[model samples]
Target: MCVYVVDDDPRICRLLARLVGLEGFEVHTFEKAAMFLENLTRLKFGHVILDIDMPEHNGLDVLDHILHQKPYWPVIIISGSTAMDDAITAFRRGAIHFLRKPFRRDDLRAVLSEARKVGVKRIAAYELQARVMQVKLTGRETQVLDAMAGGLQSKMIAWKLGLSIRTVDMHRSNILAKLSARNSSQAVAIARGLGLTQ
Candidate 1:
């Protein structure tokens, strides 16, 4: 995966590029947020390491831009100063984590690991929403599939939905056919993979 480093400090940028690269990531360093936004579309994979202090446009503004554009792209905020307000703002703006400058490599690694896990879930949810639209699943069918996604058996689903087992089975079959899944497990697999289930 790629890692985009947005920091005005040349030394910090180079250091991060080298360190992240050593960890097997394709690294891209940007001196400013505008440049990153200009080429945001081409940045298709992985997360971003953003410095909270920058000239002209602050890191919070950049974070807002990123959130407005592609909300799924995980961002880790790094700052030289220990401003609790900034850290709080970053988190509220959807930053995965806020790291104080001169952070340890291990800490950064842990944050990245968590961010990637979140990114995968976001992607799955997005895919599931798209598939729901494409398949034209009714609200009732969606509820049944959601129950199945939670590993509920048809009879339980029927009871929960106040329907007959036969109706539940019919809904399950329709869900499987619409999703192009052969069996309950396959349908549930799609649901799980697409993050339809909690």
Candidate 2:
């Protein structure tokens, strides 16, 4: 599994990269929270080692954004702060682990090992859900369902897709049937749960 180390301290980043690399995992280091957040969408799925104390966009903010967009990715908080409140906040925000600075290498390795196992399971679940959607919905039906999830009515979807309103409605009906949903709203909810629609 890939591991991303985000810290403003160059020394800490280098130490983490070296340690994680020795464990046979790919490592990427970012010196700024903004830089990491800007490239978040383009980066592949991986575990994150984040520092809570940063100039702007602290680790908690980044953690929230990651959970909001990619809840499956594991985040490990590494901070020099001794405040118990920081640890509490990190756990509350869904961090997988918390490590203090000057921590043992063995501790870091253990956390990464655990994160990798959980990451594999979550990724497999996502892929399975995606395959189920692919098997159940036609290409056009998926498009229509995505549009519905985006709060577009059949008329708007029809105009955007250059299809008749009747055709769009038909696709919506098919989506509902294939997903075993009672209504368009239910279909959208199912699609979202399956991670089929953004």
Candidate 3:
């Protein structure tokens, strides 16, 4: 599996790169978020080992960036702060593991192994939850979401429901905004996780 090692600490970065490389996996290391972002799409990476703190862009920012584009890339954050709020924030951003610094190698490997097993391309949990909490739909939105879950388009949903395409589009927008989800996929992920959609 392809793994990205992003850290500001040179020694730590090198050590991780060496270790990950030795596992017969492809490893890419970056000292800054800008560097990582620059070449982010060069390959399809499986997991990211990110530091929670950096001079400019922290792990959260990078996490958002990844989700914005590469929505399926699971992250394992390495935090030296160990602040509860920080860990919570990182978890909210969909990180699989928030490991404190000075952690063992096996700890990181475990996180990576889990991420590789649970690859999400169709949905994310947080966006689904936000969608559920925000929408005030009385079965209509639920119906729309069910069709969406089946990969139906607005016109298709409208055709099936005997409603105009414009109405379906409006419902779609409301679903996106109400759930605070940035996109349809995110909304679906969150909605499904919340059990708002069957």
Top candidate by lDDT:
2
lDDT of 3 by residue, 68-153 (tens): 77777778888889589988998898887788988877876777667766654333554555555656765777788788878899
- What tens digits encode model 2's per-residue C-alpha lDDT throughout 56-153? 77789899998788888989999999999999999999998999998999999999999999899888898866757565778999899889998999
Clash counts for the predictions, in order: 0, 0, 5
Output the better candidate (1/2) by TM-score.
Answer: 1
Cα RMSD (angstroms) for every candidate in the order listed? 4.7, 9.8, 9.9
Alpha-carbon shift of residue 30 in model 2 (angstroms): 0.2
**Estimated TM-score for each candidate:** 0.73, 0.67, 0.59
Looking at model 1, residue 58 earns an lDDT score of 87
* TM-score of model number 1: 0.73
lDDT winner between candidates 2 and 3 = 2
TM-score of 2: 0.67
What are the lDDT figures for the candidates, one per model? 0.86, 0.90, 0.79
